[model samples]
Target: MESIWVGERVRVRGIEPEESELLMEFDQDSTFMRNNDRLHPPRSKAGYRHYLESGVGTPNDDEFGAGIESLADRRLVGWFGTNGIDKNSGVFSYGIAIGTDFQRRGYASETIVLLLRYMFGERRFQKCDVEVYAYNTASLNLHQKLGFVEEGRRRRSQYFAGEYHDVVLMGMTIEEYAAAYSLGTVESS
Candidate 1:
């Protein structure tokens, strides 16, 4: 997260070459994997490495840039990015760990707010979307609080662990995004 910004308690940065170990730590956490079922499993360290390097390093064909960072205690907390949705559409997805110590302290909201601002204001993207496990109420509420509408749902989409799970697609358009968020207020200095 060295390339990204550091707020009072959060550090956001592009996942870099040095953060390979972080991926290993993440793989060890079943709690993280269970919630984020949309992510594909890493077959090997090499695959994870390729993903990490592709996320925010160099210039990929469609990926503008992405970041992974810590929220509190300076640990690997989450990852977010402006990935290509269709052709020029900018789709975004984030996976955040509130941490064993720092759960439910508005960190995820803050991070999403920051991400939305950057994606809509700076990147000039027309839309932003996220996929969440339908059973995750906290995550579902968070997306709602951030003004994302329930775009759609895929029935029995994901079969994680031992059960079938549905994936919910949520989205906020650039129009709704700008009106719903107060990014313009911050720039009026």
Candidate 2:
């Protein structure tokens, strides 16, 4: 199968050490952190450099971590990470974080499509799952729009912003992905 990571507006590529400062800047944004990863405190720029140098943002056999860049200007806009829950069983999960400036511009959606195409179409993963915090309406809506069903919810499981919030568990099987994003070649059966 042909590997295609570039979408109409964005492309996936290895994260560079110099981009650590950009990522650290995103981590410092409270609004972005609150929705994406509120629990972990933002790391220092030097810490981020060390983290990236350790290969935390590169694809490996068990998982993948990459930078999302704009196809137009090639500027880094976000980050994406994915890993197998059970590689042998074809189960996996992925998450993304687009910079505040990049939000609402379709980069997140296209990045997801590119990731899904790679995971489901090329890698042949059977299922993909994700957990969205209840307060993140945009994410919930986006996942729903992308055809990920709300499989269940974990109530009051995550505490952030001085309140406990529900964790919405969503998933999509290969069949559902094929049906929703039928590229005319995906197997529907």
lDDT of all predictions: 0.65, 0.84
Runs of candidate 1 with Cα error greater than 4 angstroms are 1-8, 38-72, 87-102, 184-189
**lDDT (tens digit, per residue) of candidate 1 on 1-189:** 232245555666666656666666666667666775434555576766776666444544335444534554566666554443464556555455443334466666777777677666766667777888899888899889889899899989888678898889998888887787655433232
Clashing pairs in 2: none
The 10-residue segment with the lowest total lDDT in model 1: 59-68
What TM-score would each prediction reach against the true structure? 0.72, 0.90
- Judge candidate 1 at residue 163 and give its lDDT: 86
Displacement of the residue 104 alpha carbon in candidate 1, Å: 2.3
**Global CA lDDT computed for model 2:** 0.84
Candidate 2 structure, TM-score to reference: 0.90
Q: How do the residues 39-149 of candidate 2 rate in per-residue lDDT, one tens digit apiece?
A: 466578889899999867566654888999998889999988995468788989988999998898889998888788778877778899999998899999999999999
CA RMSD for every model? 4.2, 3.6
